[model samples]
Target: MSRLVEATTAEPANPEPVFLDFSSVQVATASYLRESVLAFRDLVRGRRSTFYPVIANANDDVRDELKELMRLRGDVLMVCTLGPAGDVNMARLIGDLDPKQRMTFDLVHEHGETDAGELMRAYGESEGLKHTTAWNNRLAALAARGLLMEVSQGRAKRYRPLFEDA
Candidate 1:
């Protein structure tokens, strides 16, 4: 007979989280970069939660600068957006990570109306990517993440920002 070992340990408490959204970094100058880094450090050092700073389009120069800043401080996650729009290609990246991820960016826009078929076609033309189905899938994933809003449904589905009213 073997005795089961049961060691008692107290679970760790949750910490406060922080979220930062940056739509564009190309406009941020060197001073802005320094200030932002300081702000991030102050916000994250005493917390035991996640910190996400969204930097869109950070071109080669911006990316290099930020990378250097990030190296000095190990508290931020830099999400580099690739494809037609920044961060919109998250689905494709996810697809690369996990094959099980769904591809759902189908839906077309005509006269301000959205249709599944048309949307897929437009996505292909706009991005010059071969996978319309994958684009649709990625769009759907973006919707799920609150980055997009579905405007219409059925044969056509239109989407806009959740912040449109604002």
Candidate 2:
């Protein structure tokens, strides 16, 4: 575990995307994964980056365990898997998301940008969901968690991706 920290902090000033390459190794108990990967991610989250894994190769059991951990982290964290053709694809984070936040992230990811009013207006007329105050709280929380980038737009704010490719 401490070795993981050392490898991560090698370029602590501005660490590039770190990947715990799980290609050779085989068996990994859940506790082992949580202690190693999740703990490292939390430590990195406080500093320069989030713990994003790229599963180069792993067997069925190991893959299942890792997938469960990723799901627990939710959209705030992302992982990748190498395809047969060597293409990098974002792994599906299997978890429940608050409806508003799911929409917020989807909009920003799809449209490349969005604001609270835009979300409010869209949801308001489309679904009759008028909850601007709730939107404020939700967006603020997401920004603070580093999931979305909050930009002040004079009297308002716009949300963008923190690490997502736009």
Best by lDDT: 2
User: Where does candidate 1 have its weakest 10-residue lDDT segment?
Assistant: 1-10
With candidate 2 superimposed using the best TM-score fit, by how many Å does residue 58's alpha carbon deviate from the native? 4.1
For candidate 1, write residues 1-166 as lDDT tens digits.
0110111122124211122334454455545666763444343332312222234445667656665655564323334344553224332111121322222322221223343455557555665567556655754554443333444345655544322111
Tens digit of per-residue lDDT, candidate 2, span 104-125: 6677777666777777786766
Per-residue error for 139 in candidate 2, Å, reads 5.1
lDDT scores in order: 0.39, 0.60
Clashing pairs in 2: none
* Candidate of highest TM-score: 2
Q: What lDDT does candidate 1 reach at residue 94?
A: 12
> Superposing all C-alpha atoms, what RMSD in Å does each candidate have to the true structure?
15.2, 5.0
